[model samples]
Target: MHLILLLSGLSFQFSHGLQPQFVFFQTPKTWSEAQNICREQCFDLATTHDMREMETLLEVVKDKYDDAVWIGLSKGKTRRWRWSLADDDFYKEGERSYLLWRSITDDNCAVFSNGKLNMYSCETNKYSVCFDATKQGADQYILNTQRMVWTAARDFCRAHYTDLTSLRNDAEYQIVQQVANGSEVYVGLFRDPWEWSDQTDSSFRYWNPDMLVRTDSTQTCVAMLKVNSGKWGDRACTETHPFVCNCIVKKLSFIKLRISPQDSMLDLSNPSVQADILEQMSQKLRSYNKTAGFHLKWRKQSDGRVFTKEP
Candidate 1:
């Protein structure tokens, strides 16, 4: 049997998993003002992860507000293509911006095929080429034959090697092509303009179908329309409306966890033991939604004890 300790507080218990506490503010405020207020309260504008979250938010504001509401999505100013391998020391001066794109489109992720880089949607699956910095000579670039999405490929590379291959210059690009052997392979280059206010990496988008190409420069910030079944639309940042703030739970309610240990003498209170348990739980939670980020920690009691013997 495995011990599963659950912590509850002001957090919204979603059917998917643990989620941030969302507070709906009826008072209308511009996007900037709402962001400022949320920041002041140690929170930020709400960020939805999927359609389940969209449904939850829709239920929250459907009856109270019959108009649009601010969310954290916005077109950030520093929107540019970047590499998954973020180590600056790995690239020479002026080599960081080197790219070999066959054609540029709205698609962000790139793939190397037939000695040319092609922009592709991140959801597309392809074999991944990973870079192993510790390896010497031609053995550095390792090709993973498994077909996986861009993000999953990145995770696999990070777990086994340095990262997805970063083609710094023509020399590196040629090396990657040789490793690919004419097969299309995922690379590290990608560009995403949409950003959340809290800076969380959330790729899930629920955009209104009609506003896919609605690129009005003035309407950079995003809002969810209650009348449109919570579909998101870009709006001017100066426009005022009710907003949702993602808040952190201030208090914690703990539940006892019971586990049958393989070793009878094992100490459950050991920091390493506690950490291993948390890691196990985190891995299980990640299996539900690999893209969603989760922060799990052990909450100590007033006496600095995480676990107590139940007599």
Candidate 2:
């Protein structure tokens, strides 16, 4: 009996040592940004898939002092309790322990205490941990559309595409608007009238203050004009003139300086060589800006070559 007990202790120690050490850190980031950081900088969101893993985490962090940390669980977009880390179907016919309170009310946020689960406000501060995983590149688009509408155009885009093409910045919006020649297209803009189908209680609705539902039934879709126009108006979805499609293009930039045989170092005085360098630099700048037609001029400097936009 004594020998068996000792062997069991040794096995436990071996297993614990093999487990990966979880690193903890505190960050002031939105829930989405925090999740993105985990994927881009650290790893995938920490997944407490089983009681054993949960228990292991609890034991490891039981004594460590820290505020609650965000986890992968959340009140999903539809207000359903879900594991935001993956899209796999959650099984419901499990033992009570398996159904342990990993998810809470539809508060849109979650946290972890040591390994225990807690639901919290998204704005609350907390430490977070992530597991190891590879980062995937953003998807790129080829041909895209840009359009404007009354309200109908906006609805049409929503019904057709995945979602109104979301623009992250002004530059992107400007590019799309320019391509579409100021035509309005539907975006993700919606008012309080829009109802989420998955919400358990249908009594309440989410609304964006900037956008309000129009009284006119014809104003179903939303449209935009210039990049600065932040307001949205509802219109019919059937009328199609021009539309905007958010396109992502992969770009690469390389800067090379060449040295002539006569010079011990790079030749900065050679006008021809300087021109070539400027052309390459211009091309790179255009790539970053996602511009198609642009001209560049090269100027010779004492140390290197300089590239500038051509007038």
Q: Which is the leading candidate under TM-score?
A: 1
Instruction: Compose the digit string of candidate 2's lDDT tens values, residues 194-216.
Output: 22111111111111222323322
C-alpha TM-score for every candidate: 0.45, 0.21
Clashing pairs in 1: none
Q: Which window of 10 residues has the lowest lDDT sum in candidate 1? A: 7-16
Q: By TM-score, how accurate is candidate 2?
A: 0.21
How well is each residue in 156-177 modelled by candidate 1, as lDDT tens digits? 8877987888888787888888
Q: What is every candidate's alpha-carbon RMSD to the true fold?
A: 15.4, 26.9
Which ranges of candidate 1 are over 4 A from the true structure? 1-18, 80-117, 120-190, 213-216, 250-311
Looking at model 1, residue 59 earns an lDDT score of 74
The prediction achieving the highest lDDT against the true structure is 1
Q: Rate the local accuracy (lDDT) of all candidates.
A: 0.73, 0.31
